[model samples]
Each structure stands twice: as structure tokens, then as C-alpha cells.
Target: MDQSFSGSIRWAGDNSKCLDVQGGSPLVGAHVGLWACRADHPNQQFAWTEGDGRIRWLTYPSLCLTAAAPGLPIQLDLCDSPTAPFDAAAHGTKAICTSEGVCMTVQDTEAALMLMMLGLGSCFLMMTPLSAFWRVTAAADAHDARLGRRLGWEQPGLMLMMLVFLAMVLMDINFCPHLGREQLQLMLMMLGVLVIVMLLMMPLMMLMMFVFHGALGVNGCG
Candidate 1:
């Protein structure tokens, strides 16, 4: 209600998004506008909590209404055009939207958790083998044959990792929901274990490579 609480109307070029009403003022029937310039314009003026609480502009009736609660995205009547009446038959809820169409709904807490898990899982699958491949290539380049061979053993492993990465990415995008928080936590724990194992093994691998090369004068590509 305070005029100090100002925000921009992104769609409107004018600064008509300010909340000019004073605190404790009843907002039930107040007409909201894009800015002072358009304050009196009916297209910009909106009836709060009345007439469906929608803007009276050329835009859709349900254009930018916030959901009743947090984490709940706006529900839109997809069939309602900017110049037409809203049709309940085409209404849907979604987490994201674009000029083309609305993205699928994320649903509830479980869905959100699943999305996060899938993202992290894909990241892990992509990163692990890539890291190993780099270490192997580095060893080979350094003329450490034993190290190169040891690292080369990761070639097939890297391929499998890449396959998993691709599959996870595709699954995450296609599946409406993924693992819940508990499953996500488990996945994170598994990732942590993998990272710890890598940390413990990398040095040992390097040490072994160094010892083998020093004792045998072996070189990669030989």
C-alpha cells in the first residue's frame, strides 16, 4: 500500500507499476495502472480482487496473477488470448512459460526435489569421466606409459559415463518428476563417496605411475 514499495511493469514501457496506495487503505476496488502517465487509462487500470483480479488491457485476463502460495506458479488459461475471453478448458499450471507455450508443471515439493536431483546427477555423470579422461591424457602426454595405460583403462569407463550423462539429461527433461528429497540426499551421498574415492586414488595412481616409469624407463606409445 505504501508508495515506497515500487516495482517495474516489465511488459509496459512506462513506470506504471508503483503501488501508490497508502498503508491500511482498502485495496479491494482500487484501480492499478502501469504508471502515473497511464494511471487514468482504463486499459492500464486494474481492479484489485475484483473482475477476476485481472488486468483490463489488451493482454490476457489472467496475464500476471501470482499464485496463492509460494512455490506454486501461476495457473493460466492457455486458450485465453489477449483479445479473447478466458476458456477454462485450456487452463493449466506450469513452472515455466515462453512465447510459444507453457512449460510442464513441476507439481509439488517432490517434483522440485526431483528436478534438482536430476540436474546434479547429470552434472556428476558428465564431470567424472571427463576428469578421468583428462588425467589419462595428461599422463600419456607426460610419457608415463604405465600411467597412460592405467588411465587408458578409463576409456571404456568414460564412454559409459557419457552414456549415463546423456540418458540422465534426457530423462530429467522428459519425466515430469524425478527423485524426491530423500533420494536426492542419497544421490548426493553417493557422489560424495565417489569424489572421496577419486581423491584417495588419484595420488596413488600418480605415485604408481611414477614408480613404474622410474624403474622401467617405460614411455607411452612404446
Candidate 2:
């Protein structure tokens, strides 16, 4: 091994992390994430071809850095062979060139504003159906109370659950925005699971509404 850092492409800072293939896995889909610089790590070695503008993995000469799409994870893929069609997107776009050989670009402020707007829109979309369902339940319970029947707890229970859900959503939006990449990924995973669960429960919610209304109608409480 050469005793110099000529082959290693690392960040400009003295202690900055290097671009590393996650876990040093030799698989085609191995993720490219940042890791602490290790002089001896082959995963941190990459070759940038100025002529073709392709960043190739030195550990696997046949593999090159490939991006499937915008906002997706980068991974190693088979290098574009001569027979393959020329993919103009494989090259980098215009960016703020730095003295450290790092390309910088300012994030679009409109994107952030649109994301915030989408989040608020989703909250309202979710709340609209829930609030309407709870209103129906409240009306049923009110009728039952007038008829000398015991009041059901479903209305209050749903309200409490909704409050807790909103609180969690608010925390996610207002809490620390400087979380580490891994922490942010974990949080997003958990949120995704929560969303899946809510989606799956939609049918069950409909069933509950049908049963509650049916029972109330039979008791002349609707």
C-alpha cells in the first residue's frame, strides 16, 4: 500500500469524515455514507475520472457511484460500459465550487416552504375525517344520555388519542433539526411505521363507525 494519502478522497478539514461505502460491503447496492477517515480503509478510496466525470470505486474497479434518482441514496453499481447508452445524468451539475475541491449549493428555500405546507395539509386531511367521526359519536352519546342510557367512553377516548397524536406530530416538527443522520433515519422509519399502521386501521375504523351507528339507531338514539 502506498504510504501517502494521494488515493484517498476525504473531506478538506483535518478531522472531517471520509466518504465510505457503508460497512465496506462489496455488494452492488451497498450504501455510500460518511465515516471516520481511516488511512488503511479501501472503501474510502475512489477515483474521479475528469474526462467522463464518473467517480469509480477503487476497491472494485468495475463499480462506480450511481444515483438512482434525486433524493435517493447513492450506491455502487456496475460502471457504465461502452455498449450502454450514454447517461448524461451520471455527471454532476453546476454547484458552488470550493477551494477544498468540494461542490456546494444552497438549498432551495421554496422546497422547505412546500414541505411545511404539505405537512400542514396532511394534518388537516387526517383531522377532517377524525373530527367528523367524533362529532357523530358525540351526537349519539348525547341522545343516549337524554334517553336515560349510560354514556359511552368512545368519544372521550378518541379525543384523547387525537390529542396525543397531534402532540407527537408537533414534537417531530418543532424538535431538534440537527439530529445525526442515523438518528434522523431511525425517526423517519418510526414515523413511516406509524403512518402504515394508521392506514391499515382505516377499515377497522369504518367497521367501528358502522357498528356504533347501527346500535344507536336500534336504541332510538340516532
Would you estimate the TM-scores of all the predictions?
A: 0.18, 0.34
RMSD of 2: 24.3
Local error of candidate 2 at 30, Å?
Answer: 0.9
TM-score of 1: 0.18
Candidate 1: Cα lDDT at 136: 11
Q: What stretches of model 1 exceed 4 Å from their correct place?
A: 1-149, 152-157, 169-178, 191-222
Clashes of each: 2, 0
**TM-score of candidate 2 versus the correct structure, residues matched by position:** 0.34
Candidate 2's error at 1, in angstroms? 18
Q: Superpose all Cα atoms of candidate 1 onto the true structure and report the RMSD in Å to 1 decimal.
A: 22.7
**Tens-digit per-residue lDDT, 131-164, candidate 1:** 1121111111223212221222232333464355
